[model samples]
Structures are given as structure tokens and as C-alpha cells.
Target: VRLAMGARDLENNTVEVARRDTLTKETLSLDNIENTVADLLDDIQKNIFRKALNYRQEHTITVDTYEEFKEKLEEGGFILAHWDGTPETEERIKAETKATIRCIPLAGDTTPGVCMVTGKPSVQRVLFARAY
Candidate 1:
């Protein structure tokens, strides 16, 4: 059976450790391994997905003005804001705020507007976040 690899568990897993907790003689039963893997998969599909989706929803923000964008950017999380779609404006925003446009959603707000930084016309909003 295939195991589901959840985001939370994968994010928490660390390969480097101070010491080995398990002894050489220690072993796991096939049933235990299968059950653990199965449980993890279920958690990934149900719990992790929901948690991540919620996190994104909670963190996402929309701004029509540069002032609003700057204020929200300081607090962290993703910002869905209109960009003038110019390299100069994008670079200036990133240089000032340490945030970069992460992606343009396939189904984002299609409403035309002005860029937050340059006040130039923008076709759509783009996702922006601080570099990790």
C-alpha cells in the first residue's frame, strides 16, 4: 500500500540528530510499520491539507494601495495585491519591503487595476510573500 506524505510531518522530519535514540537490537513489527504509515497518510490527506489551506486563507490579504501593502507586508504572510506588471516596480517593491511576488494564481482576481507601487495599470493581482 502507498503511504501519504503529509506537509506537517515532512516539514518536521529532521535527518541530522545529536544521537541515535533507537538501539541496534530494536525492531518494528510489519503491522506496526504498516499502521503507522497508513495513519500518517491519512493525517496528511485530512489534517495537513486542511491546516495548510486554513493557514493560506488566514494569511492571505488584498490591498489596492501601496500604504496598505507596506503595512501588511510588515506583519508577514502572503499578500494578494495588484502589481503594475513591470520589472522596475517589482524590483523596487522587493528592494524596499524584502518581499517578492511568489506566483500569479491561475484563477486570481481578474479585475484590472493600478500597481500598488507605481500606480501604473495592472491586469491582475499577484501573490507576494517574504523570502524564506
Candidate 2:
């Protein structure tokens, strides 16, 4: 989230802008206010997207075994693991690790594999996570 506040002094024809993202304040002439704010908004959007992408890349993990999955779950992030398309297996994993399937991602690697927990045939890896 980004916040910008402007304190305008009409008598002096000056606008002081405080930016939340950079934690900086700058005084600008009235003529530059619109252009400056527009630029800052664009920078804020790119900054937010970059941070989120970095975080996901850092936290997301792919595990091939239940032991690895449970170990990673303790650290708390998204898990990509094979799931044998079965409710019973899904329920067991949740009951055991308190983690549930967040999604069967439609993108990325769709290679078939054996279930991490059941050893049954799995169509693809699925995303798993625990509520934060």
C-alpha cells in the first residue's frame, strides 16, 4: 500500500508531498504536482509487484516427499507437491500437518508423478498451505 499526502500553501504556491512508500517528503511547485504524483503512483505499483514476486519466489518450495513437506510446513509458506487426487489422502495430510491443498495450479510444471504421501499416481503437483 502506498499513501501520499499533500500540504498546500496557496499563498506561497507550494505543495509539500509526503510519500509513505519511500518515507520521504518533498516540496514541489504547483505546476509539477500532477506530474510528480502520477510518476510516484507508477513507481509504487511496480515496487509492490516486485516485492510480492520476490516474496513468493523466496517462500515457495517444491517437495517430493511427505517428510520434506511437513518439514517445510513448519517454516510456513506455499508447498508444491504431488497429490493423488483423493479426498481421503487430502484429509489425512490436513489432519496430520494442518496443511491443506490451496490449489492445483493451472500453470507451470504439469508433469505426472507419484503422490508424496500415498505413493499413488498423481496427475501433477498441487499447491498446499496452512492458514496464516
Best by lDDT: 2
Model 1 Cα shift for residue 49 (angstroms): 2.2
**Model 2 lDDT vs. the true structure?**
0.87
lDDT of 1 by residue, 1-132 (tens): 233344553565422211122212222234456565566556556765787889999999998888999999889999999998888888999899989999988895799888888888889999999987
How accurate locally, in lDDT, is each candidate?
A: 0.75, 0.87
TM values, all candidates: 0.68, 0.79
Shift in Å, residue 87, candidate 2: 3.1
Give per-residue CA lDDT, model 2, range 1-132, as digits (tens): 233334436666776777776677776666777787898888888987898889977989999999999999999989999999999999999999999998888998999999999999999999999998
